[model samples]
Target: MSEVPSPRLRISDQDRESALTALGEHMSVGRIDIDEFGERSAQVTAAKTRGELSGIFADLPEPHPLLDAPKVAVSEPEKPAWADIPPMQRIMGALLPILFIASIALIITTGVTWWFILVPIGISAVGEGIWGKGWDNAHKKLGKQRRRELDG
Candidate 1:
């Protein structure tokens, strides 16, 4: 399209140069890799007419004015491990272990029936912890082990 209307018209040096620059622009943004660029550049250099030069961009996306506008980078979504946990579940996961351990210490110091109440609460806490975070944590542990093996 950079050339004159005649398909058989002999391409000038400036036309070949322009085509090569466009190829570089496409490659810079990962539209094509180094091997494809080399092959296209070779074709561009060997092209004798306007038609031959046009063939190189046939399959590539058309470089319209809209496409030439500034691009916005799309970032990956956040992946916080705790994002899916309910507030009460998260609180239970954090508090149950500490309170259970403290209750054990209290029971040791004084033989009291009040400490018995912690038994069901301790079980509930453990269950909530497993439900809320167990799968993600297990996957992360497995991934780490696999990576360590691979790296070794």
Candidate 2:
């Protein structure tokens, strides 16, 4: 008669605890979904020791197989220089010329060369536009950084 292969032993307590800790860290950092975290935690808790934990993991398919596999890093699509500018900034930029014209008309109506006022108002509008663009760029960068860190 042919001999049968022996079944693998279950994990031991120490290993199971270690695995649970690692799974907890992953879950805390939002790497794994709630369901996956619960399932893995249950598996680890069920294991009595290290060997049993190893056996349990060995039987399961690789988690994030894609992470283990080689992959090309995809570059983000090129954003237009103006794309980083916020809608409000873009709208303000569009209105700058009109504002400048209105300011000149006001200066003429007042019989004062309030052209000086135009300079400060134009500068302020430009500053706001620049500030808005910077804010948008920072937000985009932060979002990308978070996604990279989370492997999402």
Best by lDDT: 1
Residue 56 displacement in candidate 2 (angstroms): 6.1
Compared with the true structure, model 2 gives a TM-score of 0.27
lDDT of 2 at 101: 80
Off-target runs (Cα >4 Å) in candidate 2 are: 1-7, 48-152
Write the residue-wise lDDT of candidate 1 on 21-103 in tens digits.
88888988999999999999999899897778778888887541121223456899755555665665556556665667777
State the displacement of the C-alpha of residue 27, model 2, in Å, after optimal TM-score superposition.
1.2
Q: What is the lDDT of residue 119 in candidate 2?
A: 74
Give candidate 2's error at residue 93 in angstroms: 90
Clash totals, every prediction: 0, 13
lDDT to native, each model: 0.69, 0.58
Listing every candidate in turn, what is its Cα RMSD in Å to the true structure after a full C-alpha superposition?
12.5, 13.2
